[model samples]
Target: MSNIIGFNNAIFWTDDTEILYCEFSNTDPNAKLESTKAKLYIKAITTLCKGKAMPFVIDLTETCGTFTTSVAKFIVRNSELKKLRISESFIIGTTGVKLLITLYKKFYDPATPFRIFADQNLAQAYSLETKQKYHNSIKKVVEDYK
Candidate 1:
């Protein structure tokens, strides 16, 4: 029963509160994905996540940006916030992706599972885990109704 609510470039999937899956394809450079959109998504999910033992996977594989310092800070803030809510959180950036891990080295916390994979397998694995969690939640609800 996992659902993704999105519009244009921003997408938020609901499966794991601790682990939110998001992808931003900047259709226009001026819009700036890091603005309110990214922050809202983070705040919304964090509020919903509460105390779930979930992790996060932010897929920036299709993103295109200047990778400015501001955007990097936004990503870092959200990543750290996710970790605080979940057991752990990781950001998955593909080869030649938009977000640059090096730029945020100063703010990078080793305790958080920050990583970049050559491909989307790691993100996919996280999504599958979220799906399973959703399925179980739904099953439990159905059993309760029965």
Candidate 2:
């Protein structure tokens, strides 16, 4: 079982050793993400990571509900998340305008890798597999790619 760490009315946020996992809250599928609540969610992530770079596995199911501009900014552009050190991110259930809107909100930070997936399990597995690929390789390349 996952350790219960924080609260969300319509989103499920779980903490693990390798990544931050988020999905729609089964308890409140109809819940909407208010702009006011975005801060709480963003802060929770930075607090949990505590400066360690980690991958994010996000399920955007509930996000299809009424997500506002402020909420999008909070999720994708908050300067506070710099401390969270997001190594990479994996998203599920986003397409069309929603995906484009989200893509627009995220400012390109070349260091951060972003990917989309259809399956949470695949995203999770890849997140773990690619953990070291982003967080560990700091030294300059002494050799060309094989």
Candidate 1: RMSD to truth: 7.7
How accurate locally, in lDDT, is each candidate?
Answer: 0.54, 0.59
RMSD to true structure for each model, in Å: 7.7, 5.0
Give the alpha carbon lDDT tens digit for every residue of 2-23 in model 2.
5334564434345556587766
Question: Who wins the lDDT comparison?
Answer: 2
Count of backbone clashes, every candidate in sequence: 1, 0
Tens-digit lDDT track of model 1 for 7-55: 6776766563335666666644344455566667766566545544355
TM-score of 2: 0.66
